[model samples]
Target: MDAPVSTSPRPWSPPPDASDVVKSIHAMLHPRNIVVVGATDKPGNYAERIWNNLIKYGYEGGLFPVNAKRESVWGVPCYKDFASLPEPPDHVLVLVPARLAVQVIRDAAASGARSATIVTSGFSELQDEESQRLAAELQQAVRETGLAVTGPNCLGNLSAGEKLFTNIDDRAVTMVQGPVAIAGQSGAIVMAIRQTLEDRGVGIGYMVTTGNEAGLETTDLMNYFVVDPSIRVIVVYLEGVRNTKAFRDACKAARAAGKPVIALKLGASEGGRAAAMAHTGALAGSIETFDAIATREGVIRVQNLDQLIETTECFVHAVTPKGNRLAAVTLSGGKRGLLIDAFDAVGLNFAPPSPGISAELGAMLGPGSIVGNPLDAGFAAVVDPTVYMRAIKLMIDDPDTDIVIIDAELPKAPHELRERNLRRVNDMAGEASKPVIYVSAMSIGFTDYTKELRQTLPHVTVLQGLDRAVTAIKSLIDYAALPKQVPDVASSSKPSARATLEKILKQAEGAALDEVDSKKLLKAYGIPISKEAIAQSAIEAIKIAKSIGFPVVAKVVSPDILHKSDIGGVMLNLTTPAAVGKAFADITARVKKLKGKPKLEGILIAKQVNADLELVIGASLDAEMGPVVLFGSGGLDIELMKDVALAGAPLNEADARALIGRTKAGVKIKGYRGKPALHEASAVKALVGLSNLISDAGQRIASIDINPFLINPKTGVAVDALIVLNNEAARQSFDKSTKGKSTKKGGGH
Candidate 1:
């Protein structure tokens, strides 16, 4: 069969000039020289402002203005073009149309200026076919010339140490230089965050906005950021990711570099998804999907601009909450209560300062401050603002307290005093490299001071709002604790992605398997099966019952009555031949009554096996996670609990064991309380055994339901199982079975 038709766009791609554009932004940071391609005094032109801002911002780089229309722009002499420059500038800033932006970059690249900022929009995102064609043509030019572009619609980039200047917010222009490097797709968002950083008085190393992300994607720019010694914290405002594999690799590289990447990713809703597809011609990896990959890959995803900035700071500044412990220091009763609720919601908690220290802090302040985990430093700060420092020091110094959080709003009277207190508290936290979260109730106050503190103490992550303050801390804790990758079981049997299994998984179809067929497929996979002789009639059923054993389970094994008990399709616990004969007739008769017709497949007498616990595990293809295994409470209601834990199959013993523990059944399977535990480890091995079988069989199995896999508690034998066979459905059954084994006994099976 042919592959499905395409609907999602060709992943978002910026023009080759896009990086050249971003490089232009990066160049402004420490450019040897900057050449303005469309320099002019025209009121609407960006030339005068660019020239003026370069000079005003104290850019030491030489400036060359090029405008055929003017000899000077903002009092700077203009060159006709790049050929006229005395020496090539490190960056060529272009504020021209799309067609001209390409030429500007080509000129720059030819002149050894390999980077150019294109502060011009109107390309593919505009949905103008002509413009898109032009955009593609321009992109080819940059690629051929090997120059990098930042944006055609981007606001431009920034580097504080380089003293690079573009149209970034003026407030951010005043911000100092530091280790954080921001690569944003949304110019407005990056600038806003820059402003926010500036408001907090934090210094930034570089701010790159990949407008329309035409060429130098966030990952491409980050590729350099991960290696740049000057950048410690990487913040990104992402509209969309063009290449996930590239991003995943970059994230791994960044993690190894010890650089915490805080990302503000967009495109969550249906409309947003459509826009993402259209804007960049890229698939909108949904928020949750993106989160899973990012989390797995070590990229911290944040929601809003606020989350973007705060999380970035925490990632850079704070260590993981050592032991799920937080210390909340707040003044107001309401604030403290809110903090508690927020902490609970986020799955983090305040470890009250140790009794010895809590007592000491209380004594120092006496009746003034309510010293507890949520230390009410409010009352004490009024008496001695240094009490803020004292309270913070108390929390940070506490051996049991891993994280200290101050949720307070201090007035601007004491910049020096607060800085002293902050640094003192900073020193205390620095002793053990502990983390501190400062939450200013209002967004307005202490912007400058907060910035100063964050810059001084890279680990002191500050935020606005009580909820944000709490959530950021908790998310940091949780995100840090997440495992890197679940163990892979497919490599267990060294299963080489057999063609047969692939075909089975890709295209299989069938209803539930008959018991005999289930065992036949298991036999193919090297799974053991019970010895049973099928009896064609009541006489045969009794004869087989006696031949097999006296006490046997006479089950109505027919595909018709899938739920045997509902229609009296099963007759169990029979010891005598006479009883077995009666059960054979009764079960078939009952089925006839229920369905108005019953064609007996014959009665099979199977040995009755004692079980400690029933495990139900199988696989059903999850469109998202792929052929994932499932484990849950066994018996009929396995559907109801869905108490499943899964892993992709071809599992090894270790992977199988983990798969068992991953389910709610771990404790129960291990034997809970006084009850004898099932042989989970052995059962896991059995599961691995079965999965390898399916992997080997290829196209033969659809789904395997190890329902009521009467596991012998003492010996841990998987005494009974049902393997469904059909098509690709069976290929996925391996995972479903592994995930479906149970813990809860239910009312009864």
Candidate 2:
């Protein structure tokens, strides 16, 4: 079952000491000896396949198989249990029924096994009471015995460098060791990624499937890979993260070591989240929060398997580009057009050729070429292959180009023309100062000859399909352009400011604060709010409206009525006292006629402020990620537009500005069409204030919404505000206080 979301503060704690986790994970991945607990030679048995794989892969360590029913299997002795073994193994593979898996782990631990992989299912993933009890017992076993465990519902792991293969998949037999390490929550995804990388000539150094992650999580594997010397890039396929802080730290460590980390994360859509929950019993957090974390930590996120494979290939083989500028040369005009379209779709543009370079290409290609960003070399290059190399050289030499691409293909079999042309392009790429990549017109599998060509030109980066190649290029450039420093959370608020907010919260009675009280909270944080006041009667409302200004806005103030305008409780452009009085009477009468008699808390009379644009800025406590701030287009159609951006809060100035820039409201605020630019600095200040407010007292405040925050050229003002308190937290606080008072009275007696 999914864990309940908490309203209290869930402060992120630092991960366990790095050296300790790394040491434990290293032992699990590179065990000295392995024992198969449920090993048998019965047909279609998982343990039998795993036992064969260990022997087939040439594992040099000791391998002991245990089964009470079998005397001997495959010329190896089968023991009854862990107690009967001659010596304790360092690792144990448990492939028994769910009811017996916990006992097997206990036996393995008692026999001095340091780690184990539980391949049995029926744990928390089953989401039944019995399954949960088993899961709890397994967790207790690991904690009591200090045993490093991999999974209770997962395939086993593999260490390519050590020739240790414990996985049950058939594809594990052919995985070649390389510099890339793969860690995933799903076993099938791990094998699929491993196959794709190896098929594309990218070797895999390590593969780990952290199914259910009963004891060891994907973050543990990530920490290990970051410190390992042989690994250069880390690939992760995750349904959800167990520890947010540890995950961030691992990504940061990889970035510091100059190793790229690519993630293919699920749970962006509702169905995907449901599937993840059913598959692994993981509570998938919001995708926006994950994206914010990924961006902050400099991790590359891919949308699909193709993008993951293609992006990984580029990072492994190609040099990082200095900028987004690109230049390409193609032999066919149609291919060039497709390249342009692909690049444009991803918001990338090719570097326009310099006049000198364009003229030189025009003269050299006999005026048949239309030279631009993606220069087409024309059909003449088909006869005279030197044209391809010379054009590539000029494009690479151009001052504006940061990376160069050339459309070409490797021959499936030895052909004189194709081989000669490919060789020339390879030699040029070898010497070019800028990064150069080879692109095929369409996606194709590698033939034996293609593999041979790749071996010869190990430095050349080859990408298939125009769309996938361009997407990968964008990832490469974006990764290269990331800032070196991760922005820290905005500084804490002053003690006086925090104390004032706390006092207001303690005095509030209901779950939600009315607009007047909400504005009071905003004003304490230095956020500009509309000039408003609450009036108990129509005469008082008219008196306040006249004092504020001639034209004013009157809104009903009630904790029960969140959407006041929907109940005809809001009156705008009240030009006189008569109008304000009538609005107050109308709003109260409408509330009285409602099906449920909601308690009316008078009306608010505020000055009407003209705005150039309407925007929403708010902050709330995320169950997993803590405080998060949201900004988007506001007004009644806020839900319909759905154009917004979210980021984990306590945001610095730069983060706040970047969050705004991600939304469409940011574009309109920057003088869209003939509109003059509004006060964006004011908006940034408000967002930063809201972020800091939530971070300071997020335990008490459930959410703070400032919708339709009207902005003009001069400043921005919060026209409507709503603050929802964490009702659970308030009750807990009250209970604690009452208990303390009762204890003191009893002591006095």
lDDT of 1 at 396: 75
lDDT at 546, model 1: 78
lDDT of each: 0.63, 0.78
lDDT of 1 at 383: 79
The TM-score between candidate 1 and the true structure equals 0.66
Best by TM-score: 2
lDDT of 1 at 329: 74
Q: Please, what are the lDDT tens digits per residue for candidate 2 over residues 111-230? A: 888899988888878768999899999989888877788887788878876677898887644545688999887888888888888778887889888888888888788888888877
TM per candidate comes to 0.66, 0.89
Could you give candidate 1's per-residue lDDT for residues 1-749 as a string of tens digits?
A: 11111122221233355444334334434556667777767774555665656566766556677777776666556778777677765677888777777777777787888577777777655666888887797778767876667777777777666556766344427735677888877777777887767666566778887776556777887867776677787888776665655776778777777676788876542211111211110122245446534655567777787766666656666766666777877767778778778778866767667888889898878765566677776776687766666666767778887777787544454466666666665666666656777777656465454444456755466677766666677667776665544333343443333433454334433344556555555544444455676677889888787788767877777644344566776677888988988988887777667642544566667877776666675543222222334455676656565555655446677767766876676768877888876766556755776667645544344345556666666544333444444433333432343466442210000
Candidate with the greatest lDDT versus the true structure: 2
